[model samples]
Target: MHAIVLVGGKATRLWPRTRWQPKALVKIGHYSILEIIIRRLRDCGFDRITLCIAHLGDMIKDEFGDGRHLGVAVDYCAEERPLGTAAPLHLVPDWTSPAVVMNGDILTTIDFADLHRQHTTSGNLLTVAFHKSLLHAGVGVLRVRDGRVQQIWEKPNVEWNINAGIYVADPRVRDHIPRSDAADMPGLINALLADGQQVTGYGFSGQWYDIGTPFRYQKAMKEFLTHPDRYLRPDAPSNGNGRRNEVALEPDGDRLSVADLSPWS
Candidate 1:
């Protein structure tokens, strides 16, 4: 199966660290986030991969050069400008088989092969990977009717199924994306849903991290440092001392205020 990995975000939330480098090049452990994603895709039996790149794209091209070292045939789809998320699908070559599309900065142990199997057999136009997330209100809340307080709920937790930045789509799914404008994944999914197309969400529970912000980057670094084995492949080669050397976390800089520029919801 072909995997279209989107590695072309400005990553404004990561600030000065990503000011000169692409988010894909950010190091989590010993390997860059892009390398880890490629290795995982290869392990999942995806032999052909396409990287949609922009924002210091040359560095990413220089680093992964043909993907020979990673045991996969690598190809690239360069974006002249920021094309949201789903718009890039229109830039990539058409596919006859189901293709997996995901953000390149995600750190997860998701089983792509299983995802593909489910997507293909279900006969859905699109299958999105979803993870359960909880949002907690930081302060107490009150409900009032007219001049009287009806009820109050303090610090309630809201549960939601979040899009995990991964998707398996049929070839026809591309028809919904606009050819000359910015269109996001949420918009595309909504279009499909409004047209009565079959769209389903596959739920997963495991180690998943979206390394887009400083908080998430630091969290992923700490998780990999503490539980290196969970992030590393079992077949990965070990040092002569029979242990894998963990990569040091990069130093944190002053936090920068980032606008909500996420293309995906």
Candidate 2:
């Protein structure tokens, strides 16, 4: 199946480090973030990949040309201008099937195969992966009746299903996107809702991290290092010995075969 990874953003939050390289190129242990994501997706059956890139896109193109090194057919869709999140979908050439769309900066053990299966069965135009995030209303929140306070919650912690930056969208769904302005996933979902199209959510309990900041990147790296096996599947191809610096790409001491993209080393 086809998968599109959005790696175009400037990632302004991750300045200095990102000032030099895109967030997807940032490394966790020995593997670049995007490389790891590709491997996981490959394990689950996503063979055709398209990288949606803008800022430092040439560098990304240089890093994984044709995706042959990673055992996947990797191509790119360069954004001539900044197209927010969902807007880049227009540039993905030839839309025939439902493709998995996600940001390149996330680290999660989401089962892409399962996600696709669910989407096929449900016949939804759009299916987004969701994670439970705690919404903290930091300031005083009061529900008053004219003048009397009916309810007041201080620093309330509400659980909400947040978009996990991952989606399985039908080819027809792209019809909802307008070519005029930059758009994001939220706007697309709202438009679909207005059109009465089916949109579903798939929640995962596995580890999920967004490495858009230094602290979060460090923390995610630590977590992945602590339990590398949990996130990487055994199905992806590995280099000889398959053993990288720390993470075991193969189980039972067997290693996933990978080409030594010396530059990455």
Candidate 3:
């Protein structure tokens, strides 16, 4: 399967860090966000990857070059002007079916293959990945409508689901995106909903984080450090024997064997 990542956002929320590098290049623990996504997608049997880039497009191309080093071939669709999330997918020429699309700012362990399979077999125009969130408690005082005193309510938490900004979209859906620079994903979804297209939501109950803001970017790194096993791809080596610096890569042949090298150490 082929995958396209929307890496074009300027990431103004992450100013200084993003001033020097694109959000996709922003570090989360040991690897950049783009690298993590690309590696995970490759592990899930996706070999062809295309990055949609606008701001600092060259930096992304220079950093990952051909995707060869990451065990996946890379291609790029540079948006001359910032084309909103779903619009850029229209730039790819030979996309025959629904393709995996994801935001470059996320750090996740979602199985892309599963998400894609759900979209294809279900015959939906689009598939969205969402996560159920647990809300935190808050303290508040309430007044009664009658003369009787109203009860005080303590902080309470709630649960809800939110869009994770990853999608598997049918190529036919591209027609819904407008030809404007400011067009975004929300507008596309609203159009699909109004048009009565079959858009299904796929729930992912696993590790996922959007490193869009400074707080989230930092928090993600700390979280990964604490629970490295949950975030890093299983194909990547573990720090099981107190060795937290090396990863085994078969750059040549495709077999599950390890050859140790001190490249990063």
- Taken over the whole model, the C-alpha lDDT of each candidate is 0.77, 0.79, 0.75
Give candidate 2 misplaced runs (Cα > 4 Å): 133-157, 234-265
lDDT of 2: 0.79
Give the alpha carbon lDDT tens digit for every residue of 131-200 in model 3: 6455554654333444554443344343445688988888888788876655777788889999988677
lDDT tens per residue, model 2, 1-265 = 9999999999999898899999899999988999989998888898999999999999999999999988899988989899898999999987689999999999887778877878777788998887654456577555555576655556555545556899999988779998888999899999999998868777665568888788999999998897777568633322211100222122111111121111232
Candidate 1 residue pairs in clash (backbone atoms < 3 Å): none
Residues 53-109, model 1: lDDT tens digits = 989999999999999988998889888989998998877865678899999989876
For each candidate, what TM-score against the reference?
0.80, 0.81, 0.80
Lowest summed-lDDT stretch of 10 residues in model 3? 253-262
Candidate 3 Cα deviation (angstroms), residue 20 = 2.1
Task: Show where candidate 3 strays beyond 4 Å.
Answer: 139-156, 234-265
Higher-scoring candidate on TM-score, 1 or 2: 2
Candidate 3 lDDT (Cα, 0 to 1): 0.75
Could you tell me the TM-score of candidate 2?
0.81
